[model samples]
Target: MIDIQFRREDSNIMSVEMSGHAEAGPYGYDIVCAAVSALSIGTVNSLSEIAEIPVEVVSANDSGGYLKFTLPTDLTQKQMETGQILMKSLYLSLKSTEEEYNEYLRINSLDGK
Candidate 1:
């Protein structure tokens, strides 16, 4: 299964970490993996190109299972707003996927509580 963890601070997303394989299908034909990858990479692109914010991204160098990004703390007000929108969109998309593929995907939130 794919495990995704979203971290938040002050009610704003601070970082995200995704790991594990969805193995719902063959290696090249896992729709669950594809959906999560597309949503995540698209969100990263939007954050950099559309929101104009710099995020710290890390991925497994020789593997296919892990991805993570940390939002910068020094974003401008407008950037912060746009980033939140993009992040929320990602969360919703992932949530929808989780609802359909509960056996293969999971989403969790860490609010520093």
Candidate 2:
């Protein structure tokens, strides 16, 4: 199963970490994995290319799968807004995926509590 964690600081999404394969279908044919990957990679690209925000990020595919993004400590107001929008889109996409594919994916509430 894929495990996803989203972190929030002061009511703002501060980071997201996802790891593992969905194992929902054959490796190359897993829609769950595809959807998750698109949301994560797309949002990360948007944050860097469109939002133009510097982010602490890491990704790996060697063992299972992994991706993480941490918001910069200091951001201009516009940068913050754009990054938030991108991350929020990710959040919503993952939520929708989880709703339809709960057995193949999971969203762990690893948000700073």
Candidate 3:
């Protein structure tokens, strides 16, 4: 199973952390993992390319399957709004995937809001 966590602060998402493998299929054929990787990497790229927000991202170099994305502290007001939109889009997309593949994917919001 894959565990995806969303961390929020002051009603805004502060970071997103994803770990674990979605053993829904064999290596190179896990659709759930692919969906999640695409969403996460795409969000990072969009934050840099579209929102012009330089976020801090960390990924596991080992085999544990871990990725964390955190927003930078110097974003302008507009950038913050745009970044939120992109992040929310990612969250909703992951939620939809979780709805379909509940056995393979799990999403938790730390803020519970």
Candidate 4:
């Protein structure tokens, strides 16, 4: 399972963290990549109309299977609200995709069930 967390540090900054477990191999990498890609897209879309914010991946540990990102900038109330929704949607999508992919790999690994 993957846990994604988003927190508003202040009116001008937000942070996101993602961690999860999956089959140790290519499957794990695929899941992480998918989640990161979706996150990047969601962030860009959410902040496009707002000011150009600085996004930094604070840390990412493959061994521990976790990633943290920080985004900083002043944004309007409307933008903040929209960003919250977008972030939630992105996280859910990533979690769902990871589960689905892991299930597929599990089934494929079976000999002949």
What are the TM-scores, per candidate, against the unseen true structure? 0.96, 0.93, 0.93, 0.47
lDDT for residue 29 in candidate 4, whole number 0-100: 67
Regions of candidate 2 where Cα sits further than 4 Å from its true position: none
Candidate 3: list runs displaced more than 4 Å. Answer: 62-64, 110-113
The worst-scoring run of ten residues by lDDT in candidate 3 lies at: 104-113
lDDT of each: 0.92, 0.88, 0.89, 0.52
Candidate 3: RMSD to truth: 1.6
Ranking by lDDT: 1, 3, 2, 4
Q: On residues 42-97, what C-alpha lDDT tens digit does candidate 1 reach at each position?
A: 99999999999988999997987999998999999999999999999999999999
Residue 76 in candidate 2 has what lDDT?
91
lDDT of 3 by residue, 38-60 (tens): 99999999998999988898999
Q: Tens digits of per-residue lDDT for model 2 on 9-55?
A: 88789899998889988978999999998888889889999999888
Residue 10 displacement (Å), model 4 = 11
Candidate 4 per-residue C-alpha lDDT over 1-113 given as tens digits, one digit per residue, 9 for 90 to 100: 44555565433226666565444347546555555555655666455544344456644554755666665556566656766665556556655664666542211111111
Ten-residue stretch with the least lDDT total in model 4? 104-113
Best by TM-score: 1
Question: How good is model 4 by TM-score?
Answer: 0.47
